[model samples]
Target: MSETTHAGNGISTEQAGVEQELVDTVLASFDKAEDPRLMEVMQALTRHLHNFLREVRLTEAEWNTGIDFLTAAGHITDDKRQEFVLLSDVLGASMQTIAMNNQAYKGATEATVFGPFFLEDAPEIPLGGDIAGAAAGQPCWVEGTVTDTSGNPVPGARIEVWEADEDGFYDVQYSDSRIAGRAHLFTAEDGSYAFWGLTPTPYPIPHDGPVGKMLKAVGRSPIRASHLHFMVTAEGLRPLVTHIFVEGDPQIEIGDSVFGVKNSLIKKFETQPVGTPTPDGRDVHSQSWARTRFDIVLAPGSDLR
Candidate 1:
């Protein structure tokens, strides 16, 4: 690289010659975008990307490697598996976006990442019914109430729940079945709900693709703390996407791979002796059961369109 100096500017003209021209041309191409927001975003993105390349003095080999990695990520993605989300999560971009979008409300449940495993049209179950569906794990009784910021019950709220089994595998992970540990139900008149589920256990995030290779290269673990996923919504409130983490899970202190754990969302799972009667009138006979209560508070707002 030869340096060409500008007498008045006191800077190397070569550094700005080709780089600035490319950036200006790219940014100018977006000037005719019909949507104002699209134009603004493209302009900002182009400038930032060009600035990054200049700062790093990126080599052609390195840039090609990045393109190849992203191509691999896209090729691995499908209807059930999302490699791009895993890539965003490991890079911290997903968590940063979640934090920016979810400002804290007075009494609303804190929001977290909606992991890639959530299935559309999960089976609907009656309140107090079991969602385990032949999955193997310690039986647990989960009960809760839904209330607004003003402390009034929000009846008929839809609650969607899902989790992994004791062996740390979601229903989608199994080749033979895809219906365990997931259900949706509505709150009763008093905003109370209950269901049978498994005690959450620490599990590794899916890690056999590009994201996993990246983690290995960076010496980061792929574990996520034990937690039950929840998505709650009502007639006129901001929807809550969160999880109730198991209090004593060792992975919690290490931090979740997806960055979804919140201190306010942690809850204790108490062990009940065998032969104990449950709130829903089921008796624990051969195996002891675990129990926990998690009440939800929704932020008062217009429904999401």
Candidate 2:
């Protein structure tokens, strides 16, 4: 008979001995994977998963609850709602992956989680146009330039922006077919772009799902800091998907639900009085308006596949 050993959880030697054998068995099953990357990933995933279970001494009830939670998360996901991504964000996994993929490039904008609400083929708005649609919110003017890491302009770059209304709800939140606070536009000759948006306001992430329940169970809030989402792309440079956080937002200091905020992305939103001239040559009619500038620097190099 093999020598006996006891785990921290008092798991018997026979049980702990079978654990490594189990991991080895699972890894061996992936030996026939056609892709080498697939085999490597499977082996690593098996090792990590086994290690996690062994370290935590997970119980059957807890494992069942996790499975149920994931099942519910998938059940609620659809065209407009992505509960899985929300789950990943709250787990800090998404941010960790982003940090790993986006190595530091001098002058290049730091990347963050691409929250679940970004829509493809968002309405295209011309320069100096308004993207707020009919959404109710304080008007905000957003202007910026797209440049390479070396400070050279990236002409004709595509800049996409989206945000929630002052009510902290995105256009997709509504059942009706209304588009608000989302648009895309191209940078002008000198790599400049301008558009009207809404003053960012802190809002809770969609908490009507499994992720919400998990947060509640863990005594965590589901609130995300106020910010506007941006995805900038240009020829011969890596795409930048990021957000500009509103400076002084109480939520900023407290911590974002998804851990997405960065010091460099914080910008002051200046409040302008009525009758102030807008950058696009339009007059501000509201009692007060806000403006912000967010210049983006893209890293040189294309995505390798």
Candidate 3:
């Protein structure tokens, strides 16, 4: 029957198909949807899901199993944790879509997945503050400058940083008392910023649900390369969401969990002697761990101001 006739009534139709049923259900809920963007999202999602079902000829048993997996995923979410984000990480959706959209602002730095561990209010600190705490790991002195494409520094840019501990776990993953590996540093008058944090270590994503099952079925590992996450923004420059992966991270040149790793973003942390002064004016640089520098370039824009 025609779509118009099927609109208001659940008219019995033996010839009804899965796509038709999906359209009717989705359209009914979106009857008041007037935004073009919202309509595009709904239409694309509907088309893709229908196409996927037809391509696989999905069975009822398989669908039920999928539903159970999703249920478990949602059940795992808590006030401080998000299982849905984990699912996206494992499925590579987070990186694929975020990276695709971030490509327009290339030359800033390669953006990566921001696994759900960032806090709403990270303590604001001055540049070169010690962020590594007392955790015993490779000492990495990271210094960088926020600049515009024309090569001028974007002074007073705020930079937020977070990375795994020497043991590959964020401070939040350990105890609330432990806030290591997370720092908020702002650029100096010349747009230069510096800090000390432990070198990030490779770690595994949460593997407990439908996404984990899919990983097993595909014979893929849940490990992600070690890296540092940074969100930098200035008064007039575009905000940059990116990461600096550890040099030689096996997953860097090879298999990244979400294909978000880029060669140019890999940084080598070089060890220093034990008698040199630390970046923060401490006289222990020689005995310190290592150091790496990264300069960020932002495109001209006042959108993030």
Alpha-carbon RMSD of each model: 2.9, 1.7, 5.3
Per-residue lDDT tens digits of candidate 3, residues 1-305? 64442333453343346457766787567657899789778877876787687557689999998898889878878766687887787677988877666665546655677787877677776777777775657777889888887788887888889877767677776656677778787888888989877777887765665666778889987777888889887877666777888786677655766565877778887777777667566655346567899998887664322
- What's each prediction's TM-score? 0.93, 0.96, 0.85
Give the best candidate by lDDT.
2
Candidate 3 TM-score over all chains jointly: 0.85
- Model 2: per-residue lDDT, tens digit, 183-297? 9999999999999999999999999999999999899999999999999988789888899999999998788999999999999999988888777667666568999999899
Order the numbered candidates by lDDT, best leading: 2, 1, 3
Query: Could you give me the TM-score of model 2 versus the true structure?
Result: 0.96
Candidate 1, residues 1-305, lDDT tens digits: the string is: 55666444544787578678999999999999999999999999999999898777789999999999999989989887899888887777877887777778786888888888899899999999988897889999999899998899999999999999999999988888669999999999999999999999998888898889889899999999999999999988888888999998889999899888889999999988887788877865678999999999998775322
Off by over 4 Å in 1: 1-11, 303-305
In model 3, the Cα lDDT at residue 207 comes to 64
- List candidate 3 stretches off by more than 4 Å: 1-31, 208-210, 283-288, 302-305
Q: Please give the CA lDDT of all the candidate structures.
A: 0.89, 0.91, 0.74
Q: Which lDDT value does model 2 have at 142?
A: 89
